[model samples]
Target: MRQYFPSNLKHLCSHYRSISDVCNRLKIHRGQFNRYLAGTSFPTSFNQKRICDFFGVEAHEIALPTDQFLQLISSRTPRPTLAMITAPQRAVEHLRQCSSSRLQDLVGHYHEYAYSISHQGRILCSLVSVKELDGHIVYERVEPSASRSNGSDRTSCYRYEGVAYYLGDRLFLIDYESLATSEINQTILIPSFKTRNARLNGLKMGVTACDHRVPVCSRVVWSSLGTKACGPEAFRKVREYRDDDQELDSDLKARLAKAQIIDGLFRII
Candidate 1:
């Protein structure tokens, strides 16, 4: 797979001091850092995390195989049944049609548990938390690495958590949610991005499981005008509507419908 470490090294230089300085702070060998910059070597999960933390970047941003490599690997891996790939793609397409504002809002709220699939076929999903500060949102994802010379890597993913989020900045995966929750304080913020909705839809489409529900104060939906206003019966109605479907529960259906409406409105406006 094509390596992402070189560009990540450039990103590090923009954010930190010389490679030697970064190595010292990460406690990795300077030579290793040089190799990383040259794309001749990759940091173990531990170092990848450390460098990411040091530069305040996501672990996946630095660790995920480059596009060329991912494509190559995916091609080599046996293709899933045609049904498997198409379903997720359709669901993602439905999500993309959502309002930019609501999408931005949802991402800000549940930035942690949100997953984004790009047009380029890259998938970034989160199992972490969202932090809101000074009107800005921060999403973080942490992955464990096998121990290496730099001690284990400690990089994490950070984003705003919505369809509108930048692909490069917002995509990620956490190696272990329990470990991340224990290490950091995870708080649920405002449920604006219909992240709850996306989660629900993901379940319905079989892209994810129904059990992956995130707690929300209430559910909201989009009006015909494509404005994101609160709906009193929307959540309940969603529940009632989905109650009949064998694959989804009333609660999940409600969440998914809310997300779809919001996402649809996002696209309309």
Candidate 2:
């Protein structure tokens, strides 16, 4: 019944500057918007109302078969536009435009370290790779964990795909957990200005994977592993480690410690 929804939604979005613009207007995550565009999932009734209200169409009308839906909106006026795009949107666009030129130096593999959300008191290391794609910087992160479930060694992997932006001397990365699709993570790191890329430290904000799903914030460190280590061998290294694990050096371990407020300001040193 909703087969036409994807195509109709695409048609509506084509009138905007970009799908990003449409998602911004609808207050939807870009990753979730893509699922609707690809027909892999349907928007909930609440989202349907938001979409319908934004496009001046009825819910039933949007579900019409493509040909009829096209004809229905044929005489519709041009897509609406604000007197000026919001300042935040303009800033985002500017950052996206700047990412391609500014992030080449950081396009490589990294070992991402953070306090484990699933296994408290352990440090988790995930494999991450960043690269330039179509004038935009995109990255993929893979988390591989091994545990004994039902008396058997089972490995569970979680993957995330996200975009990176360098704006105002800081690197911003936002991604949704692709495997679960229930979490969106944001990391803000200090960009490396040195001639050589080095360990970059930042804060990560996201909900835990536990059943309770408590929101947690933790300090994270990205250690450059260069371009060659992003293959299968790299993934082998993605797992949790004890605090005394030799792989986690003293300096790196120090950086990932949970932060505390000092003088009314939270700091990750």
Writing each residue's lDDT as its tens digit, candidate 2 over 209-248 gives 7789898878899999887656776776788888788978
Clash tally for model 2: 0
lDDT of each: 0.37, 0.82
Reference-based lDDT, residue 251, model 2: 87
Identify the runs in model 1 with alpha carbons over 4 angstroms from their true place. Answer: 63-269
Q: What is the lDDT of candidate 2?
A: 0.82
Name the candidate that leads on lDDT. Answer: 2
| Clash count (model 1, backbone only) | 17
Superposed model 2: Cα runs more than 4 Å off: 1-92, 98-100, 146-153, 229-232
